[model samples]
Target: MSLWYFLIDWFAGVPTFGVLFKRFMINFAWVCIALFVMLVFQLPAEYAAIVYFGFIVVNGVMGFVFLRQRMQMRD
Candidate 1:
């Protein structure tokens, strides 16, 4: 299997903290992408705030949906 898939499986299999770890990693990746975009575009402070807020909202919603799906699959 690919290393990426293996890492994901490893993270998911962690005792007690797998879900939290996955969510954190997802958020961290989104932050990195957002920062890269902001740096490349050199957004103004106002727009940067908007972008950051949007990314946070998106990340939270995506995380929620992911958890919900996982829960459904477990039942």
Candidate 2:
């Protein structure tokens, strides 16, 4: 496998920290995508801010759901 994939898989398998690490990476990806869209479309400052806020809220909800599912699966 590629080095990047190997590293990601290794980190993801780590006991407790792995979950947090994966969540952080997912959130970071969302932020990066939002920034890319804003820059590429040349959105106004107000619109960009709103888009960023929406992405954050969506990420939070997704993370919560993911964690909840993980907990349910563990039971």
Candidate 3:
């Protein structure tokens, strides 16, 4: 299914909390794996922090988009 549809459905309570949490953990697992590899390779601390910061920014944008979509649907 489309990304927008998936997010909208999740926000609308179509999926149970367990399912959503599981999905989040699964996706986050990959991010953790990538970070681990970067650490193992001895990447510079400043670069590593930038990667983490990017993740935080993306997460904030996703939250904003989800909230905006939900609000639009309400109107």
Candidate 4:
């Protein structure tokens, strides 16, 4: 998807963005989905999105920690 490309481009050293925006963009799909349901499906999407984003953050943190340990072990 285009959003994924944007994230990769930003990760590959776009000068304008830093880690915070990168993380937010990584999770942007959920925000967009939440918006769509509110507009189209007539559902309460916000609370579910908050939970989804929380899960995403937790997964990202765990992945980062796992990768860091792997690199340290390799060294």
What ranking of all candidate models by TM-score puts the best one first? 3, 2, 1, 4
Residues 1-75 of candidate 2 have per-residue lDDT tens digits of 799996455333434546766766776787789878888998788877886787677556655666675787699
Instruction: Output the better candidate (3/4) by TM-score.
Output: 3
lDDT by residue (tens digit), candidate 3, 24-67: 56546766887899999988888778777766665555555556
Candidate 2 Cα misplacement greater than 4 A, ranges: 1-37, 40-42
RMSD of 2: 6.5
Give lDDT: candidate 4, residue 1: 64
In order of appearance, the predictions have TM-scores of 0.47, 0.47, 0.63, 0.41
Overall local distance difference test of candidate 3 = 0.64
TM-score of 3: 0.63
Q: Which candidate leads the pack in TM-score? A: 3
Better of 1 and 3 by TM-score: 3
- Going through the candidates in order, what is the number of backbone clashes in each? 0, 0, 0, 0
Scanning candidate 3 in windows of ten residues, the lowest lDDT window is 10-19
Query: How does residue 28 of candidate 2 score in lDDT?
Result: 74
- Stretches > 4 Å off in candidate 3: 1-27
> Candidate 1 residues 1-75, lDDT tens each?
899997566444433346655766776787778877888998777876876787677556655656676787689
